[model samples]
Target chain A: MSDAPGVLTHAAVMTGRSLRISRRNLDAMITAMMLPIMLMLIFVYFFGGAIETGTAYDSYVMYVVPGVLLLCAGFGSATTAVAVSEDMKGGIIDRLRSLDVGGAPVLAGHVVASTVRNLVSTTLVFGVALLIGFRPAASLGGWLAVAGVLLAYIVALSWISAAIGLLARTPEAAGGFTFFMSFLPYPSSAFVPVDSMPGWLHGFADHQPITPAIEALRGLLLAQPVGNAPWIALAWAAGILAVAIGLSGVLFRIRTA
Target chain B: MPETMIEAHGLTKSYGKPSDPVRVLDGLGLQVPRGEVFALLGPNGAGKTTTVRILATLTTADSGTARVAGFDVVADRHRVRRAISLTGQFAAVDATQTGEENLRMTARLTGLSRSHAKHRAAELLERFGLTEAARRQVRTYSGGMRRRLDLAAGLVGSPEPGVFFLDEPTTGLDPRSRRELWQVVRDLADGGATVLLTTQYLEEADRLADHIAVLNGGRAVAEGSPETLKARFPGHRLDLVLTGREAYLRLAARAVHHSPGTLTLGLPTDGTAAHARALLDEIDPHRTDVERFSVHSASLDDVFLALTGETAEEAAGETTGETTEPTEEPTHV
Candidate 1:
C-alpha cells in the first residue's frame, strides 16, 4: 500500500483525469478540430484547382488528405504542450509530485491524452476530406496500416510537444512554440511535392521526417508503388518517440527537482 | 517527548542562475513531534514554502538532510510522500474538474480501489462541507470553498500516521473561513496526526500552533511555545484614549508616547492590578480626561517584532508581492 501505484494503473487514472478536462474544455476542443478542417477547406477550394498534380483536382484530393491528416495530428499534439505548461504552472503538478503516485504518471497522462485527442482530430480531418470528394484506393488492411502509422506519428509528436510545454515559462510561450512547429510540414511533401521546391529546400524536404511519413501515407492510400518509405517512416517515428520520451523525462526531473 | 514525525538539519536551497543566485533557504533546521500543530512563521522570501517543499519531497535541498516519518527526504522520497499530504500555497485542485472529480482522482492516484476511491471522494466532500457543490465545477467555487476542497483533496487517501504539510493554507481566507480551517487543523492534531503549517500572521500562529518557529532570512530566529515566546517579551502595557484632539495634544506634551490619529497614549507597566490603578490615579483627570483605558499583556505580534524586526502586517505585504496570485489578492489577515 505504501508503494507507488503500478505505472499503467496510475497512468490510466491520470489519463482519465486529463480526458475529463478535455471533455469539459469546449474552447480547446474547438480550437483543435477547427484549425485543420479550415486548412483542408482553404487548401482544397482555393489551391486545389491551381495546384499541379499528375491527375485532376479529384485525384489531387487523395494526395493532400494524407498531408492534411499529418498536419492535423501535428496541430492537435501541440495542445498537449499547452496543457502540460498549464499543469506545471498550476499547483496540481506540485501536489501530484508530492503524492506517492510519482512523476511518470503525469507525463504518461499527457502523452496518452494527447494521442487520443490527435486520433479524434485526425479522424475529423479525414472525414472532412472524404466529404470534399477525396477517396482512398487502399484495401482494408492498408487503411489499418495507415491508422497504425498515424498513431505512431501522433504519439511521437505529442511527447515532443509535452517537452516544449514543460520547458516553456508560460502558456503563451508553449502555444507560440507549437504554432511554429505546425509550419514544419510546409517545406515537405505535405502541401506540395518535395521535387517542386528549389534544390536546397528540396534536399531538406526529402530528408526530413514529415516527407517520408507523407510519402508512406500517400503510397498506401493511392495504391502507388509501396517502397522503402513505410519502413523509413516507421524508423523516423520510433526515433522521434525515443528522443521525445528521454528529453521530456529529463525536463520533468529538472522541473520537479 | 513524542516521536518526531519530521526532522531537518542544515537544509539549504537557492534559485536562479548560479552566477547570480538567490538563496531561499540557508542552514534551516526543524523538528516536529507527531500530533503537534507546529507553525513555521516567516515573511515573504523567508523560505517557508521552500522548507515545506523540501520536507514534502517536492523539491530537493542543496545541502543537509530532512526526514519525514523516519524516512530520509532525499533517499527515500517516495516513502516520505506516502506518509504525508501537502496543501500548497496555491489551490491545487483542477479548475475544470468538479470538486468530487478532483478528490476521486487523487484517491485513485494514491492507489485506492475504484470503489474505495469513490467512497473516499464522497466522504471527503461531506466532511469539507462541499457535498452540495461536489458535482459543480471547481471554477465556480468561492475562494474559501476552493481552499477547503484543496485541503480535502490532500486528505483523499487518508494515509496512516498522517503527516500534513500546509503552506499558508489560510492566507486569503476571510475571518470566518480562517477560523473554520483552524478548527479543522486542530481536529487533525487531535486525531493524532502531525501538522506543520506555514503562515505570516501572528494571530494565526497564536490560535492554531502548539509550537511556533520564527523564520527570518531563511533561518530559524526563535522557536518555542506561543506562551513562552510571549514570556520572553515580559510585562504589560497601559493604554489610554483621550477625550478630544485638544486633550490628545495636551497629553502628547506630558506623555512619553502619544498618537494624534488614534488619540491614545501607551506606557509600559509591571502587569499588576495595583500598578494599573496607581498609574491611572497618577494621571490628572481634568487636563486630559480619560475617555477609556485598558491593560494588556505582551502578544506573539510583539514577540515577532522583537525577534524578526518586522511587524506582521509588513510580513504579509511582502508575501503579496512575491506570490504568483491565482486570483484577486485576498484581503490581508
Candidate 2:
C-alpha cells in the first residue's frame, strides 16, 4: 500500500531471514564449524612431523592455523551459494520481486550472513589451534590487521558465491560451486608452502589471490614483516568484490527477467 | 482508483532462442475493471501464467503495453508492484520459517513497522485459520495450510484495495481446499479488490469470476460472462444410451459425439420437448434400439469444446507435450 520499504530496511529483513535459516539448519552449521577444526588437527598431528614448512615455528599448529582459517572462510561461504540458489529455485524470488524488493538487498543479505558465519567458524578454529600449543607473537595492532584482511576476503568470497548461486539453475548445481571454492586454497599456499610444490604449479601458486591472503594472515599473526602483502590482499579482495557484485546484479536480472 | 484496474494491449512474449523462439503470448489483450473478478481459464501452457507474470511485474512482455492500477507495468514497475499482490503457482513461504514468521517477514518487507508487523502477522494468521499452526515450521504444513499462508503473506500491508493476481491458485488443492480458496477470492472481490485469477477448472470460473476469458494457444478464444459464453452453444444436449453397438454405430454419423466405450450418443437439441421427441423418433421410432435419452442444459465445458474444437483435457495434453511448463500437479506436501 505504502511505498515498499527502503533498500536498507529490505536488506535488514532479508538478513534476518537468512540468519534464521542458517540457525535452523543445524547439521550444516555444525559441519561448517567442525570441518576446519578437523582439518587443522589432521594437518598438525598426522602430517606435521613428516612435512616441513621451511620456516622456524614453535609447533606445526602455528604454521597450519592460518591456512585452516582461510579454509574455514571458504567452507562457510559456500553455503551462501546454496542459500541464494534455493531462493532462486523456489517461488520466494518472484514473491519478493513482486513486493518491490530489488536484487541488491537480497544478495546483500546473503553476503552479510555468510560473513558472519565464516567469522564464527574462524574464531572457533583459532580457539582450537590455541589449545593445541599454537602461539602467536602478534600485538593488538597485528590482530586487528589480520581481522581486517580476513573480513575483506570473506566479504569478497561471499559475493562471488552469491553470483554463482544466481548463475546456477538448480540448488544441487549451485552446490557444486562449494567444491571449487573449498579447493581454491589447495593450489595456493594454504596447506604447504607454494615453493615446496613442483616447478610446473608454481605459476598458479605464486600468482593466485589466495596466496597473498594467506601470506598476509600468516605474517600478521606471527608479527613478521608483512612487506606489502596486506595491501595486495586488500586490493585483490576489493577487485573481486567489485566484479562479483556487478556480476550478481546482472545475473539476478537475467534469471528473474 | 482507476476504473480499469488492469489493462493490456497487443502483449507478446516468447522463450528459447530468437531463431527458434517458442511464443507463449501472442498479442494477448485484456481489461479488468475495478473490483471485478476476471478469470483466465485455460489448459497448461495456454500463457495464463505468462500474462499474470507480466502484469505482476515479475517478468516483461516481449512486445506490448500493460498497465496495472493505472501505472505502466514496465516504466513504473515500482509503483505497480506497490499496488499489486501476486500469489504464484507455488506457495512462496519459507519452508524453514514458522507461518507467523513468514507473515511478519513479509509485513516488514512491505514497509510495516516492527510492532505493526507483529500485530498484522497475528491478525492474518487468525484470519486464515493458521493460528494453531503459527509456531510450526511451514515445511510441516499440509498443502492446504501452506496455500492459505501464502495468500496471507500476499495480503500483508495491503491496507488499501489493490489488484490481486492468482496464477493457478487451486491447481493442486483438494476439493474442500479449493472451495475454501474460492470463498476467500469471492470475499476479496466483495471487499472491493480487483481480482484476476487463472485456472484450468471451468467450474471455478463459472462460480467466482464476473467475466471469463477462455485461453488457448496464447490467445483468448472466447470472452464473456459465464451465461453469455454458455449461451453461445445456443441449445441443450440430448444424451442417448444405445442397447447395442449396432445402434450406436448406426447413429454415430448423425450424433454430435459418439462414445464407443459407453455406447452413448450426444445429439444437439433445441431444448424443446418436440425436438427431443423428433430426434428420438427419427433415430429409433419404435424405441427398439435406443435404451433411454435425457436432455440437459449446456455447461461451460460444452462452450469450451465448441470454441476450441477439443476437450480441455485433450488440449491440455497437447500443450504439455510441447511446452516446458509442468502439466502434472506439483506435490508440495
Candidate 3:
C-alpha cells in the first residue's frame, strides 16, 4: 500500500488542478452559474401564480430544492465525463498513463472538478431562490445539514460519472449519457410530490435514494422534521458511494489493464 | 559497457478471438542500458508503440518477464511508475489550461510541493523555450509549440533515473521543428536519461538512437547500433543527378536503376572514389553534369527492408489478418 499521507496529498493537489481548469473554462462556469438562478426564477415567477399549494407557494421551491440540486449535480457531473473522454481521445490519456502518477490520483483530478462545480451550482440556486422571496424559515443548523447531504450525494455520483467518462469509446457517447442522467432526476421527487402519484410510483419513489435525500433537504430547507429521512438519506448516500467507488475501480482496472 | 536500466525477455501479448488469438509480440526481448537512447523503428502498425507501451508499464505482456530500473512491472508497478515519463504523439498538456498550469499540474501529481511545482514548471517552460507561451492556453499554440510544451510537461516531475518512453514524437512535423525536437532529445540523453523512442522516420533513429531495434510482424527483425546495422548491409551506390530528362533516360538504360522524375541514376559501387568517377565518365558530359551527389551506403531503411524480408506496412497487414486483442480482462502493464 502507498503511504496514506502521500496519497491524500497527491489526490488533493490533483483535485485543485482540475478545479482551476474548470474555473478557466467560461462555458462550464456559465452553465453552473446560470442553472440555479434559472430554475429558481422559473418556479417562482411563472409556476408560483398557477399552482395551488396547501402551504405558501414560496415554500414549494423548498421541496423542489432537493430535486433541483440533484439535477445540478447530474448536469455538472455529465460534462466532466465528456471532458475526460475528450482528453483521452488523442494520446492525452496515454501520456498521463506514462507519467509517474498512480491511477487513483489521475481519477481524483476529474472527479473533484465535478463535485466542486455541482457545489457552486447548488449554492447559487439556493441563493437565487432566497432572492426571489423563497424563505426556508429554517435555522442555520438546518441549512448546514441540507448542504452536508448535498455534498455527500455529489461526491458519490461524481465518481461514477468520472469512470464513465474515462472508459467510454467516443466523446459523443459521453455526451449522450447525459440524457440518461437527466431522466434519472425525474424518477426522484425533484418536481412533483410523490404522494400525488399512483401507489406503485409512490412506493418506488419512497424507496429510492432521491426520496429520502429530498425529504431530508426539504426538512432542513423548510424547517420540517427530518424524522426518518436523515437516517434513510445517510444509508442511501453510503450505499451509492460504495457501489460507485467500486465500479470506478473496476473501470479504472479495465482502462489501464 | 553501460549498465542496463530496462530488460524484457521473451515478452508477448495476445489479443482477439479466444480460440484463435493473435500474437502482437511473439517472443520479443529487449534491453536498454542506463542513460542510452534506444530506438524502436517500424512503419505504422508494426507494434513499435505497443512495445513501448509494454515497456512503460501501460499494458501487460501475456508471457514474459520485464523490469524497469530493476523493479518488476506487474508486482512493483509503483516503483516502475516513479522512474519513468511518457510523451505520446500529440502533446498531453490540457488545452483549456495555460502551459505553465499544465506543467505545474503534472508536477503536483508527481509529488512536488506546491512551491516546488511552481518552480519546476517555470524552469521547464524556460528550458523548453516556452517561457513566452507559458501563460497562454495550449489550444492556441502551434503544433511545434504544443509539442515543445508536451515535452516540458513530461519533465515536470523530474522522475528518478528519467526513463522516457516517446512514441513517434516527431510525426507530421516540419523539418526545422523536427530538427529542434531532435536537439531536445539529444539534450535529454546527454543529461543521462534513458530514452526509448519509436519512430517511422529512418533518419531520426539513425541520428539519435545509440541502439536501434527494427520491429517486423511484432518481433525484432534487426537489432544493433546504426553503424552495425549499416555494416550488415555492406552495399554502397553512387547517385548521379542528371540535368535533362532525355539525358537521365539514356543514362538509365546503360545504368542500373533510375527514379522517374528526379533524374537521379544509381550505380552499385564498392565505396571507392574511383568507381564514382568511372560512373560519372560513363555519362555524356553534354547531356548532364552532376548537379550535386554523394556516394552513400546502406541506411537503417535498407537494413530493415533486407532483414525483415517484408516492409513494415506488409507486417501490419499480416497483423490484421490475425486477431485484434480481446477487451475482457483488465491487464495492467
Q: Which tens-of-lDDT digit does each residue in B1-333 have in candidate 3?
A: 227888899988878887998778888899999999999988776778778778777888888989888888889876777777888876687888899888887777776777987988999998889899899998898887888888887776645458888889899888888998999999999998999999986779889999999887688888999888765554565666777777766666654335645676655666777876676676654534667665655454445545765463453354432111112231211
lDDT of 1 by residue, A1-257 (tens): 53457888889999999899988887888788898889888888889777776653356677788888988888888988999999889898888887766567787898899888888878888888888888788988788878888998999999999999988989899999998778888999888777677988877888989888898898888777769888899899999999988898899888777
Each model's fnat? 0.81, 0.86, 0.67
Candidate 3 lDDT, A24-96, residue by residue in tens: 8879667756765677567656775554445633556655666777777777777777876777677766766
Q: Residue B314 CA error for candidate 1 (Å)? A: 13
Model 1 CA lDDT for position A140: 88
Q: List the residue pairs that clash in candidate 3.
A: A257-B331, B15-B325, B16-B326
CA lDDT, every model vs. true structure: 0.82, 0.87, 0.74
Candidate 1 docks at the CAPRI level of medium
Query: What C-alpha lDDT, on a 0 to 100 scale, does residue B19 get in candidate 1?
Result: 100
Where's the lowest-lDDT run of ten residues in candidate 3 chain B?
B324-333
Query: Which is the better candidate, 1 or 3, if ranked by DockQ?
Result: 1
Fraction of true interface contacts that also occur in model 1: 0.81
CA shift of A175, model 3, Å: 2.7
Say which prediction, candidate 2 or candidate 3, comes out ahead on DockQ. 2
Per-residue CA lDDT of model 1 for B1-333, tens digit only, reads 228999999999999999998998899999998888899987788899999999998889999999899999889987788888999999999999999999989998888888888998999889889999999999999888999999998887657459999999999999989988988888788888899999987778888899999887789989999888655543355667778777666556554334556677756666677887777777754535777776644444455555654544464454432111112221221
Q: Which candidate should be chosen as best, given lDDT against the real structure?
A: 2
Which one wins on TM-score? Answer: 2
Give the runs in model 1 whose Cα sits over 4 Å from its true position: A1-3, A56-58, B233-265, B268-304, B309-333
Listing every candidate in turn, what is its Cα RMSD in Å to the true structure after a full C-alpha superposition? 5.6, 5.2, 7.6
What DockQ does predicted model 2 obtain? 0.73
